[model samples]
Target: MPATSTNTCRNNAVTKVLELEGLTKSYGAVQALRGVSLHANEGEVLAICGDNGAGKSTLIKVISGAHAQTSGTLRLNGREVRWSSPHDALVHGVATIYQDLALAPQLSVWQNVFVGAEIRKTLFPGFSILDKKRMRAGAAEYLARLNQNIDDVERPVADFSGGQRQAIAIARALLWNASIVIMDEPTAALGVKETAKVLALIRHLKDTGVTVLLISHNMDDVVQVADRVVILKAGRVAAQGALEGISPATLAQTVMTGEWPQVQ
Candidate 1:
């Protein structure tokens, strides 16, 4: 497949939802990130790909506020900001869905969706209780918006398939009104059908105006859904631009060798 140029992938007028400039992270004497920089445009799917030990995890940790960068600036919606913690980032409309999916197996789908942030009702001036009905309704609405049909939102997540669990996780993010959603290898361990569903859901997210930063080793998934690709090599950005005009083989080669292939 011919790759599309960056200019042709998306309109240049789209707002940049997240921006990182000269970002670096270090642990004692060992540096994990070396001045890596990139930007995710609004309503675009940006795939981050690299070989093992390429600092992909570290970069996302910094973006999610799990770790602070040693240097460099992070801009959200064009404004510089520092996050004190992951919750701080979430509060600012940034949400991360790790490979684990983070759904509680013992809890119902709606319960998992609003675990830490449940709705509440105050019957009196000083009394409040969990609003189970409202939470269930909200969860159902979000799931439906994602075109996910669950026979019962009250059912435990352990009974659901891998793809369904991922949908619930994404629904939770949407319920929080997240504008930027970061997914770490969402299709990992999923069967072909399940992976296809998740890929379609990711495309749905972009269509709904959500910016996605996807970190994955699956070139096929990235090529299928990503509007742009960022290749990281040993904690530094090797190559990045519009995915247009780039082939999966060329992308894999860039990940392994940290150099763009010379066109013949």
Candidate 2:
């Protein structure tokens, strides 16, 4: 079993966007997660940090509906939800941006952004056709709102920069009116400038009232973007608290050592 924290400050902000209570998952004799619990509030970015085999990926998969919890309660906006699959979670406005970005390299920018959920219209009352104009216009509108300027919405996303491609993926989630956005290693394999752009876009999402769950092994990235941090070890929460309540040194130590050594 992983550790738990009972020391919570009174003045902490309220407004829970996502919560996991007693979440557990097992495979044969090995337990992937043992009663792991965590939460992220609206307009806040929660960073889930842990080393390899820490069950970080497992937890996110459960919450994002990729995997079901063997035993636990999953709640969104104070209501318990039973998500059978990733699509089920998406129906509830939960969007996930995986490590690969999931963009079709061969597809055009607008096509990729509006791939699964494209806009269509009816022409001549009965015979309906896809609304290419509205989609192009809407995609352009969304990208522009994010301070991103892509010359051609019809251009293939493979031709865009890493930062621009990430922005497009995020814009797609926003277009769906997603309430909870989960990003896995968002800044991985990017240049310094590209990383900065991704961070700026994440802040933009928070400012727009989107709850963010950021999974990263990079402490500097977590400290820079996460409002709260949840450290997991051996499939259970080792420590969970506001970023302001803990120092980076303490956080690093807790993750690497898996022991909550009292701060000196």
Give stretches of model 1 more than 4 Å off: 1-12, 262-264
TM-score of 1: 0.93
Error of 2 at 244 (Å): 2.3
Can you write out model 1's per-residue Cα lDDT over 1-264, one digit (the tens) per residue?
110111122454879889999999999988989999899999999999998888999999999998999999999999998999988887777889989977789999999888768889999999999999988987887888889988699999999999999999988887677888899999998999999999999998888788999999998888889999899988899988777777887888878887776767
Q: State each model's CA lDDT, in order.
A: 0.87, 0.83
Candidate 1: pairs in clash: 3-244, 3-245, 3-246, 4-244, 4-245
lDDT of 2 by residue, 125-213 (tens): 77888888878877887788778988689988889988998899887887777878899999997899999999998888887778889
lDDT of 1 at 79: 98
TM-score of each: 0.93, 0.91
How displaced is residue 208 in candidate 1, in Å? 0.9
User: Global lDDT for candidate 2?
Assistant: 0.83
Point out the worst 10-residue segment of candidate 2 by lDDT. 1-10
Candidate 2 stretches with Cα past 4 Å from truth are 1-13, 245-247, 259-264
Every candidate's CA RMSD: 5.9, 6.7
Best by lDDT: 1
